[model samples]
Target: MPSHEGEDEAWLPPEIAVTVDLVILTLRASVFQVLLIERGEPPFQGSWALPGGFLRDAEEDIYDAALRELYEETGLEAGNLHMEQLAAYGTPGRDPRRRIVSVAYLTIAPELPEPVAGTDAASAFWTPVEQVLDHQVSLAFDHHDIVSDAVERARDKLERTPLATAFVGKSFTITDLQRVYEAVWGVSLDPRNFYRKVQGATGFIVPAGSERRTTAGRPARLYRAGTARTLHPPLTRPTPSAAPEEAR
Candidate 1:
């Protein structure tokens, strides 16, 4: 056997931290919004960022940690909301303290209640997506890039997935669902064409039994989310060149 070289030397593993951040998307009063938290600690103290934190322990599952952080900071449970991994952000120097890689998630929910800050968050609230994407509000760390990716992910998903249904209440009208697309896509949709496309998507929306909308318009039949999670033909959008900056 060959003589052993530096095998006796002690090896110290790099101290890399893992965290999860949530981009909770919802429609509040016809506007598309995302959940945000104000940090209370140093390294961008008092800055607004997505609600999230480091994994509680090595044994903790990433998804479970995300749910825990969501509840801890916002007091809102995931509970049937659509959540999926968005991406991983591992840019050196992104965090002032140490090397950190963050796993971002996009959570789609409908009309979530007001957030009450807790844990390490100084305050929590629903902020319109445009405010952040349009550079109105500054964020901590690399959260702006994270938010941009999450929003584009949402818009892309809206074209193929019925996740848009997750942005409305349990019961809503065709018009109600249309607004979700309009707000998220940042484009106006023709109501008639939207209704036709929705109707053609099998199992996309089932009529609510004996449920009638009681709003300003003429009596309209209510609908409950259906079994399908996608549109077969899928809704279409304008090309990036033809669309407004918001749409792109």
Candidate 2:
């Protein structure tokens, strides 16, 4: 691996540029959504693209650059965000202007205040992943693949990591937690088992001394995400085949 200064100077080919992209996900309408901005310039103009920008000389760190790009493209401040370096994409001929390598990051937010596009973007909005994936996306550069990778990472995180807790409010209910699971997993879980499993998980959630009665039927206790960032003994996912092979 090249040093930071070397990567910026000698390693970067003139035809290849470096940029940072962010995949910001949040829960809206009880479904998971990703933020996309409409590109205004050429090279996939008028197409939806991830919020990103080229690195500047003043930017010292790649992670810091990504956070800055996130705020620049979408006027939302990086609040208690669960952000991590997702991956780097460098496929030859990915960008028309030049060969571009993009460092991607995944951001999970509770509830976004609002998004205002600036610079290379025309407008920004929170879009359902299904709606965006359903269409043929010829995005700017290799963004389509980058976004796909980010989405898959988020899905896998939801499986074993306590990432879904980021979607819930400071204080939440079993139903609220259930909704996060449902939205991320895209599967309906048995309410009884879901409740039992969640309750059994040590430090997965803690009570905040609050209660709310959902219109559904019963009054539910409210809780908050525990200090634990991860589930020690990760929750086991239900496998499709639980029975032994049939006897011949």
Candidate 3:
């Protein structure tokens, strides 16, 4: 190849494709699940992967592209959802088609409605995170790594933020909140201790002036999320050795 006049041609940039992938997570039935889609097109057709797509416009911001892909692939809106940039995966050969770089996003929300698979996805559904992590189910591209990172991020966020409440309704019981932590962290917490810690956390939750009666237990006090977004004195997860003793 010939270089243009007055142009430095020592090196040339490689052609790369940029895309977005979403690891949408939620706590349902006390299990952590992630949204995955079966790719409808080639280069991994019929394989399960995180819901995402290439940037529709070169001028679009990465985050905006993520939101658009999320909605387009899964029919889930990004409004009122807790979404953040997770990590970038650009390892060569990560994508079979070409040198594709992916910017992944993580989302946490309460139980979302059944997703309608869009043009890019043959099918879409929420699958337990354990299944993906355990290799019980396969994922397309380098999505396995993306999902793993998203789960860890979610667990970390729950310890220092009011994110757990996103798993439940506006007004929830202390038990309801505790379950969210247990599901995401994959450990049981002491009921009494968890209650005390949550109540002590300044502005984490405020009493909703109501109670809900369970099947066999007495009425449980209800609470609504408060002003505070992050926890000052974080609710650290109890070690496995200490958890058993604390529960007693």
Off by over 4 Å in 1: 1-13, 215-217, 240-248
On TM-score, the stronger of 1 and 3 is 3
What TM-score would every model get versus the actual structure?
0.90, 0.84, 0.91
Q: Rank the candidates by TM-score, best first.
A: 3, 1, 2
Task: Predict model 1's lDDT versus the native.
Answer: 0.86
Candidate 2 residue 202 Cα shift, in angstroms, is: 1.8
lDDT of 1 by residue, 194-235 (tens): 889889988888998755647576687789888987778888
lDDT per model vs. reference:
0.86, 0.77, 0.87
What digit string (tens of lDDT, one per residue) describes model 2 on residues 1-248?
54666555656535566888898888888877888889988888898888888888644578878878877866556667778899988888777777778899988887776688978888888887766566544456667777778777877776567777888788888888888777765666677777877877777889989788777877889898887766766655544352121100
Poorly placed runs, candidate 3 (over 4 Å): 1-11
For model 3 the local lDDT of residue 92 reads 98
Best by lDDT: 3
Cα-based RMSD of candidate 3: 3.1
Residue 221 error for model 3, in Å?
A: 1.9
Tell me the deviation in Å of residue 226 in model 3: 1.6
